[model samples]
Target chain A: MAGTAMTPYAQLVGPVDVYVAPYGTAEPAIDAAVPSTWYKLGPTTGDQTIEHSGDLEVFRDNDHQAPVKVTRPEEDLMVTFTVVDMTYEKYARIINNVGRIATGTSGSANVKRLGFKRGATPTEYALLLRGSADSPYGLYPGQNYIPRCVQSGNPAPARGKATRAELECEFMTLEDDTQSSDDDKMGWGTVQIN
Target chain B: MPMIDPIAAILKLISDNTNVQAIVGDRVAGKHKFAQAGSVNAWKADQSCIVAKDDPGTTPDIDIGDHVGRVELRCYGATPAAARKIYNSLIELIRDLEGRTTANTSNGTALIYSLVMDASPFTTVDPDLSIDMVVGYARYRIHEYALEEYQ
Candidate 1:
């Protein structure tokens, strides 16, 4: 998926329907639903600056051959998964970087086998499937979410694609989860970018 | 698994919305292209002629999945509001795209859109919220974009 604007990215064109499982008070987004919220941002005969915030850290791929980033919309009041801590441009660069790595930086998928085997034939990469996302950053104490980039790569062949299924692994969430965090609120209960 | 027809889906959306249907393809009068590919076509028939290419092998360079590339919807109507309405429909269509299937692989772009929808009246003031009325979507597309790969 090199140049193509995939799903989560595709969803960017319109309003997002976010379901925030609140831990305490109702999310500020609930108030955004009011028509008056748009008026405060700016003037509008038809369309004008309503309200927007840039670069909330949505998701990133740590296991990627290159860094990948995803961000919440620029509009502030929009209810979204995860929180708005980072900038959109920075997160966009990360996602673009993932595409760069996947496509060999030519804006295309690296379909040609570059002969970059991940590990030794006899030995296999270890997979850590977290039981749940109840840990420190997780949404709940025992809840879980699936992440695609949590794979292992070998030291050899710094830049190339490998057999993904061969390096498959899994990890579950830890127990004694505490306060309801962004993880649970965002459906990213178990996913960790690191 | 069933294949996704991105172009078809886009056209279906435009056709479904009467407001959009009234403005698309007729550059001289309609004023809205909605979702046009390549060069802008002068006539409605020419504009609506979307060809879905099935041969990924022939074009090994092109990303085959629906969520892999950018999707644009242009509007050239009497008002920006009309264009904005079409933009809203495109957004709705994208949501439908999510409903059709899940992400195919987590390895690709974390699907997202930078929606620049029309703003509502801005005379009233509210301080509780801070975001602009630009209107946008994110994770829903990302999660659904990756779903096609998981199945």
Candidate 2:
């Protein structure tokens, strides 16, 4: 059955589309959140200056030699991540079996949790917009937003033709609760990466 | 040289410059009152002498309290004014690493800038305000790569 029907390896790359509710597009909200006064120093030639002031501060420069810096006031907030854990899974039956035992019913199911780092700060993120992918939770259509996830690639099409789990994700945000402890300083959010 | 570790660099910076103190330990000592000295006389104990005994070894060592870590900064200069000036210069130097400036310049542009024609009376007398006039500087650093970079 192993004939010489070879195929080229596929590239694993795609834009990360991100979306937010209550807005048609996230770009406007992101732009509006940024302050107009924010700016970074420039280099001599062809130097790009990045400016931002939002719920989070932003800084950037074209050249690596001159790195952009953002200074937060003592009273201002700072966001940083604490690493959690990363896991890999390759079975849907196990997930279905567990679900059936817990819920007392099961038709079929899929489960995957990769790139799930504990306490991973979620302040900074790279979103690939302009895609038709939906969130992993399936809350939205596949034409709108793509949530965060870790990614691996499959080259051969003959490998069962089923989409393999690439990355796991956790969308987190800092909670505004005042009664929470230091470890819970970031609050908590849902994790939905497929 | 490139500091191998950032935290070490920060701690070293604080230690070398600031009069920082660290709390080492806290402990509880047992206290006991002794009475009936020798065969007849009983001992009356006060807060100060509740642990007195025939031999120094018989009683626990007196302890004031536990030590707590603290940091205090002291500046020196030609005069009090000069000390202040120097201190300020050092503070600004640290702030520089934090990408901060008192002049309010960011994003390679002037957030607040003005070309003043008239000199202040204070500056006019000195002609040039040197580190001799600075007292101290305080700064905090924030590190966040702009999302625009990825864009």
Best model per lDDT? 1
Q: Write the per-residue lDDT of candidate 1 for residues A58-173, one digit (tens) a residue.
A: 56466776437665653221111221222322122112211122224345644421223323322211111121221332121221222211122221212246521111111111
Q: Please, what are the lDDT tens digits per residue for candidate 2 over residues A1-194? A: 11222211111112222322211112222212222222111111111111122453557777765547875542212221111111221111111111122222334655443332322222222222222222233212122221221211111212246743222222223233342455333322222233
Model 1's CAPRI class is incorrect
lDDT of 1 by residue, B1-151 (tens): 2333333333343455454455443232213333345655533322321111121222221333433322333332233454344445445644344222222222332222221222232221112222111222222112223324332
Tell me the TM-score of chain B in each candidate: 0.32, 0.23
CA lDDT of each candidate?
0.27, 0.23
* Candidate 2 per-residue lDDT over residues B1-151, each given as its tens digit: 1112212223334333332212101100112222346743332222111110111112221331111111122232234454444344344434333111112112211111011111111211112322122222222221111112212
Winning model by TM-score:
1
Off by over 4 Å in 1: A1-81, A84-174, A177-194, B1-5, B17-67, B78-151
RMSD (Cα, Å) for all candidates, in order, is 22.7, 28.6
The true-versus-predicted C-alpha distance at residue A35 of model 1, in Å, is 25
